[model samples]
Target: MDIRRLKEEIITYSQEIGIDKIGFTTADPFITLKGRLLRQRELNYQSGFEEPDIEKRTDPSLLFDEPASIISIALAYPSKMKTHVRGTKTDRRGIFSRSSWGDDYHIVLRNRLEKLEKFIVERYPDARCKSMVDTGELSDRAVAERAGIGWSGKNCSIITPEFGSYVYLGEMITNIPFEPDTPIEDQCGTCNKCLEACPTGALVQGGQINAKICISYLTQTKDFLPETYRSVIGNRLYGCDTCQMVCPYNKGMDFHFHPEFEPDPELAKPRLKPLLSISNKEFKNTFGKTAGAWRGKKPIQRNAILALGHFKDETAVGELEKVLKHDPRPVIRGTAAWALGKIGGKRVKEILSEALADERDPDVLEELEGALEKLNHETKA
Candidate 1:
């Protein structure tokens, strides 16, 4: 079979399987991506995943002991849901920054890639294939860029004119040699909106990101969040989208209406009061299948208290005080203390004093001190 014909067949089958975009590239993206990963690792910027075992990633030979080509695919997310933008910190709107508002992309994209793999096998029984969504050693964004799907933008995300950056990427590494696509040119051209819009200054110059400072990374990480970033977290509970929201390419794109991705009406713009009151069972029931469900309920609950603190919503002080004394997670307890401090009053002060006496974590202790200071200063006035 002609390699070009096989490539064409792959694209056709991918589209037939409901993928939004397809492209192909040679299996060596390490030449461009290795240095970036190394820098991230050296700076301790990586959230948890180690620098992809470089040999496995770069060596097309390792991917498929006899690999000849890589087929990359992208699926554009529907762009229709306008994220809520009420200025009030009290508006505990459950917002999903486009990419996550639907069914988990990892599951959706992997399923499609598996189907594509089966199709290739039926056509060429001799060909062996491996499929990966975001879990593989391969540099997915680099592969997508080389495949002509898009270019890596200043925010370090792949950006295509057709889908902006609101697309999921998947790939099939096969032993079937095929003609490769030419990479697209970078179109970012002097624009720095994504950088400026970043809430935590994660996006540094020249397209580099310190993931440790990234709100997206912070939201997903299981470790305690530093106090400095607590207030800036604002109302974002699961992930941050400020950078993507400001990108010019994302403008005017149609919203994705995939039924699997739709937000549960109760979850979409939930009341802050209800979110504060939810039990662990309720949290699981509400977000179990959603992408935000990862890291379980602790992080989201912590973020909710932080958001309330930032909002300085007095009504939340009673609930925040309850968690301050009894929440199992130190991070949640600390954030609750901070929230109560910000919502300072006689009752919030009493809770802070009690929490301070029992708190063992130094970090939580510091937060308690900060809260006490705020309360004392208010009393003096």
Candidate 2:
């Protein structure tokens, strides 16, 4: 079999099937990535979402027997919403980062990978392939960088010259000895824009992130947000885009190539107040198809309350009051108490005081007391 001819055919077929970019690399173990993951673990900087087993994460051979080469694919997603979804002063909205804009990229990328696998197997019936997206043990970014899909930018994103950083990455390991493509050189020389722009200083340095403080990671947590990060998270309900938005390479880079990735304006940037009271069924019916709903309604609703606090929306005080008094979850109840204080009103002190009497959870009671103190201080001033 002419392996070179097979690689070229795969590339041609990939473009026809809507894969924006395709590249190949030898399935050598990611030696440098192993050290990075170890250091991240030592520093306690990793988000708990990462694959815990470092060896499995860094070595492709462990996943598939005698893996000869790997194929990496990139699919460009839209960075901007086509139609502006407007919100009034009284009805401010929370934003989901561009990643969660449409149908989950996991499903979209997996479908593409399966098609590519079929195409390869038809030509070479003996081809053995294993594919995975972000959730997989293998680092998708590391594989993409090695395969020449794009240079790994300072913001920790694979920045393709044609697609910028707005691309979904996936990889497949195959027992075929395809020649590896040349990796792209780092282009973010002397540009500290992403580090400077990170709201929480999560970008510790170029190509390094402290996921513990990252607003994007924090938004997905199902616990009460640390008090310090609540304001820094601002109006984001799902993930943070400040670093990507500030990258020079990403300038003038918005692609609407894939219909599956197109954002519904209202869903991508929904009204903050309405989200405060959305039932689990309503949340599922509206956002279940999107990636942001993976952590379920609690995290989004908790973030929605925090967004309302960030906006200091007086109109949402009633909703906040209800959540504080009636929500079953202590985290939600506590977050609502905090938001009410941030969005203080004539009745906010009374609302907190009333909730304090019935609040049995120590955390919720503490939040209620703190909010009342803040309000008292403001009143005395």
Shift of residue 276 alpha carbon in model 2, Å: 1.9
| Candidate 1 structure quality by residue, lDDT tens digits, 46-154 | 7665435776766667767777788889888766544544435445554545566666778888888888888888888898998887778787887898889999999
The TM-score of predicted model 2 comes to 0.99
Per-candidate TM equals 0.92, 0.99
lDDT of each: 0.78, 0.94
Cα lDDT of model 2 by residue, 1-381, tens digit: 899999999999999999999999999999999999999999999999999999999999889999999999999999898899877779999999999999999999999999999999999999999999999989999999999999999999999999899999999999999999999998899999999999999999998999999999999999889999999988999998999999989899999999999999999999998887888899999999999999999999999999999999898888888888888999999999999999887799889998999889999999999999998999899
Best by TM-score: 2
Residue pairs clashing in model 1 are 78-255, 78-256, 79-255, 79-256, 80-255, 102-261, 103-261
